[model samples]
Target: MKKVVKFGGSSLANAEQFKKVGNIIRSEEDRRYVIPSAPGRRFSSDTKVTDMLYDCYHQAESGKDFSGTLSNIRERYDEIIRGLDLDLNLDDEFRTIAENFKNKAGIDYAASRGEYLNGRVMAAYLGYEFVDAAEVVAFDENGNFDDRRTDKIMGAKLDSIERAVIPGFYGAKPDGSIKTFSRGGSDITGSLVAKAVHADLYENWTDVSGFLMADPRIINDPVTISTITYREMRELSYMGATVLHEDAVFPLRKEGIPINVRNTNKPEDPGTMVVESTCNKPKFTITGIGGKKGFASITIEKAMMNAEVGFGRKVLEVFEDSGMTFEHTPSGIDTFSVFVNQHEFEPHEQQIIAGLHRNVHPDMIELESDLALIAVVGRGMRRTRGTAGRIFSALAHAHVNVKMIDQGSSELNIIIGVENRDFETAIKAIYDIFVVSQL
Candidate 1:
């Protein structure tokens, strides 16, 4: 029945939200551990506490008077402490943070203080023990997460305390330098804790209730995915779904721990349950669909290319030498195509083209800009037939030309390439084909 709950910045933005979190924590005895992010934007126009800390560090680095900015951050925590009516004296911690700022703590260290300070306030409000992440979360010499060491340390620490609040985001390196996860990385911390404790559920409390079938702005009132597999999540996330941190998936997936994506504002509604596998049927034609535009494809055609050995390897070596990664390589007997981000290839386009000519010796090389990739991912697609046929029919009906198509062996996803201008029309056509026609 144990659960490791993590809250995003939006969930811990203000004193009222803090109170809501306290109630949620107090209601469940097994919700023994908590992880929090820096205070997020209080309103649309305001800057987040994390952003403010970064600004303060930049000012301090530039030898500017940043005391006012630093104090505002301290007051945000102080106001939360006062509103909670806690007797905790945070002067020492505040002084410690201020001294670090004066001495020029790295940007990661400065940014992490928001979560550290907030963890203290939250612990006092809930009457739980405060466990600083820096002490327990370990990083190696290279700054990669030391999962083995972290699991051992965190598990032993939690076993000693009944309830605790652990700040998220940054951990300490071997030399005590602060190293942070990418933004929205608190989810990864929560997942690591869940795996260490073997919790029954890992709850990610954020602003949204659950994941929608498609981008809301594009498809109006799209259906929500009630249950999704880890594989399905990866596909959708790769296609630009933003519900859960992709890096956070593997830790829990390895231990078979299910993650519940829920809303702090609407706790009563059962949010999406991300599990290993489920027999529950989807309410929509596809689980989710999303895409990113602005990609460029390199088309290389060579007669009798299949007759040559190591041709593909030689071509790919050029990309590696240029420090570029290929997204997809769809090939025919005599032709091969490499797709990559347009922005990434823009700088090295001429070099890449020249390298290809020198190494692979293609008959013709052409570059197509303003390309977009759309992914239609679902487990239901595996059970149903003619999925590809239906997709092509829909696109043809809408007059949206398909540039390239790649379907993984898992059959969980099918990515279609289209022109950037035709991106919206393509998605609408496919969604209507599978979703609207069924209705």
Candidate 2:
């Protein structure tokens, strides 16, 4: 019945949030191991503690006096300590960090202090043992995460400790140098620890209650997804859902551990359950809709293209040679199109187009910009027939012309391309047919 619980930056932003987290941890006996991120924004306009650390490091690296920046960061923790009324003295730790900053510690070391400091305070408040991630987590000399060593060491460390708070985000290199994962890496550490200990569930506490069926800005209070399979989650995440860190799911998914995406502010609310598989039918037709903009499509046409054996390969090689990856390639008998993000082609636009003309030599090449991709993801859709047909029909009713379509081999997700201007309208149309029409 063990559970690996992770609290995001917002959940640990201030003392009040800390109290709530302590209560949640204390209430569950099996919640022995905890992973915490740096203090997040207290309000919409506030900067995060991690961001401040990065700024401080930048000031130091640029040879600018960062005493003021360092003090501000110290003040943030001081305020939290004063509010929590903790007896632990953080002066020594603060001083040590200040010294490190003066010595110009790398950005990774500086960024990691956020989680390290927060974990210290949380452990003191909850009367739990504090385990430094650097001691248990390991990276090879090449700076790659040594998953095998990390899993073995972390498993042994947690095996002996009954209750502990482990800082997230950064681990130690083989020579003991500090290294960090990409942003929001606390999610990765939490999942790794969960798999190491073989927890029954991993709870990711964040600001949002759960994943919404569509972007709230586009669709008002879109239905919250109660349960989603890992395959479905991958699709939605790839398209643009920000509910959970998609990469964090791998470790837990391999071990068959379900993750509960919960809201720290609203602990009473059942957020979302991300599982390996389920036969449960969704209350709504579409589980979620997400999309991204800023795409460009290159339409190439050639006579008897279907008869040419290597037509597609010849067309894609131009992209590979020009150092670009194709997002989607939907083809017809005599015409084929390759879709890619516009931003990726910023510097090499003309070269790529010219190479395509020289290598593939199509009759004509048309470049269209301002495109968007939308995904309708749901496990239920795979079982219920005509899900794709219904989605297309809804878009047709809304007069939204879908430019391209691609579905994964799993059939858990269907992706459609449309003009950037119609992204919101297309999402609304799909939501109305799948969610509102029933209501």
Candidate 3:
């Protein structure tokens, strides 16, 4: 029953938070492997250690006296060390960092120090061996993660150690240069470790208890999804539900390992279980409501357009030539609409419009902006009837107009487009019908 536990920055923000994490890990005997992120904000207005390190490195890059900035970062760790009442001395570590900073050791190196230092503290406190992520997690020269090499090396390394703390986020390239995952990448690191060890479960501890059915900002106290499939999670994450890193699902999902999204603040709560598939039924018709705004739709109408063999391909090529990607393309007998990010398309709008006129001559071209796309995703919806009817009814009752609606052939999700201003209202209406009213 080996489990890989990854704690978010908030779980390791300060000494108090660290103590809570320590207790959580000690409580579970099978939680042998640990991954820790840099200290996050102690409070709302406080800065994250990673952000502080980035700022300090930027100052050093500009050839400024960054000693003061570096000292502040040291104090953050010193405060944690004192709170934990550990006999660890970080002065030597700070000296090495200072020398590296003087040598302009890239921003990745500076940012990774947060996890490195925290891993040291975590290892000492838990009486576990400290395994630097750089030594095991491998990234190619081009900064692409080498999953095959990483799994082999990391697995062998952990096989030899009973208990160990592996810092999350940045890994080392072939030349040992530091390379970081994108922001919020510690989640990916944890998934990789889980795959390496073939752990029964991967536990991700964060500030929130788990993924909410709807955005908390839109729907107050929305229900938590007890279990969600990786496919369902991908749909929600693509739209905007961001409890877990979007890329984190790949590794564990491929290996058939389940991920438990738990809360470090409230370990008693089971949170959400993300698995490949589950027989358990969802509590609601729709598993989750997630959406994003700022999209524009381009409608092109042409006579006998459907009769043209390569009409759609020719139309899409214009967008591709302009370096633009279409989000959705819903077509009719003589009309088709292309949805895209408004901000990205704005700069290349005229070019795309001109290209469309040149390649696929149309009777008229219409453009609509400030649109939002919402995804109502759930496996339960497939087994239930009138799901789309319920969504339309809910939106209609709320006086929201749906500009477009598209359901995937799999019937796993229904995407609805609405005016940007109606985004929150639409999500609320949908939530009320499927979740709140049920309660």
Candidate 4:
């Protein structure tokens, strides 16, 4: 069973953290492919190498003296090499980086240096060959990841090498210009590598042992989810559970490759296993509770709305034309409401209101802002009776009024909209009803 192991920035923040990662990788022979992110914070007050690189790049861009910032970044890496006792000197690499920064390489190039530099350190420490991501990963002119081309190249490249360490996050465009995925995109790079190599498992080593049932900030020491299906994970991720990169699951989802979200500091823990499908029953009725704030709702009531053809379409077209996207559109025979990001909808509210009048010509329109949507998602929910009842009961007990509730047809998730002030209270109440009670 081959495994593609990707370590987060925190996992390789310093020489000591590097030692821990080296042991974890060497512990298993199946772990032939290693992906490393740039050094992260060693302490709470420390700045990450990625952030430092960004600052350094900005200084160069503004034609300011960047030598001091660049020197500080060098010291970070040099400290790690010294701690590892590696016979390596990166003076030449720094020189090259200095030249590139002076040449005004784009932000993507600047952002990627963290991963690139770390990969070099990791390779030296592990005595493995360092494979540059730019040579294997591909992006198009539009800067979107070229999946097919990347898989073909990355797969073929790894097949020949017995073991290799590839840097995460940034890839080269067809023209060979550096392009990066969004922040926390190292997760995407790991998924892509797992897909390319057709590894049986992708082990993402980070600070957390696994995904939690609720946000720890709201619920203290929440239960760690042992197993979560891809669909369940995606729902939770979309609703704001960010244990893993939401988009990273796409490539592995198609290949049916499972991901193991293991904690770097605690390697003995199995962490969470993310699969396409699983036979294991969920320990709780709800797999996870995830939600977000800053939403608004638009309700339009037109008599006999269900009888009118394309009424919903006309209403939605207004939002689309105005460059706005609606989250949920719960409807009734005479009315339907469109939920959208309040921040995105505010500037265009007047235009949308006028468009609704001209297009659908509703009898009445109601607008409400400061809403939050919480999703209680689980595959086990399909088999459980009165899951929604239990949720509302918990919320009602907490004196949180529900503004809107929508249960997906698959019974995989129930989305509850509440006043923004009640968001945390509602989640705690639901957690108590489902997870806390069971425990």
- Specify the highest-lDDT model's number: 3
TM-score, cand. 3? 0.99
**How many clashes does the backbone of model 3 have?**
0
C-alpha TM-scores of all predictions? 0.97, 0.97, 0.99, 0.99
| lDDT, candidate 2, 290-339, per-residue tens | 89999999999989989988889988898898889988888888899999
lDDT of 4 by residue, 88-110 (tens): 99999999999999999889999
In what order do the candidates fall by lDDT, top score first? 3, 4, 2, 1
User: Each prediction's Cα lDDT score?
Assistant: 0.89, 0.89, 0.95, 0.94
Q: Quick one: how many clashes does candidate 1 have? A: 0
Cα lDDT tens digits for candidate 3, 1-439: 9999999999999999999999999998999999999999999999999999999999999999999999999999999999989999999999999999999999999999999999999998899999999999999999999999999999999999999999999899999999999888999999999999999999999999888999989888889999999999999999999999999999998899999999999999999999999999998888999999999999999999999999999999999999899999988999999999999999999999999999999999999999999999999999899999999999999999999999999999999999999999999999999998999
What is the C-alpha lDDT profile of model 1 across 58-141, one tens digit per residue?
998888888899889888777777777788788898788778888998898988888888888888888889998898889998
Over 4 Å off in model 4, which ranges? none
lDDT of model 1, residue 151? 90
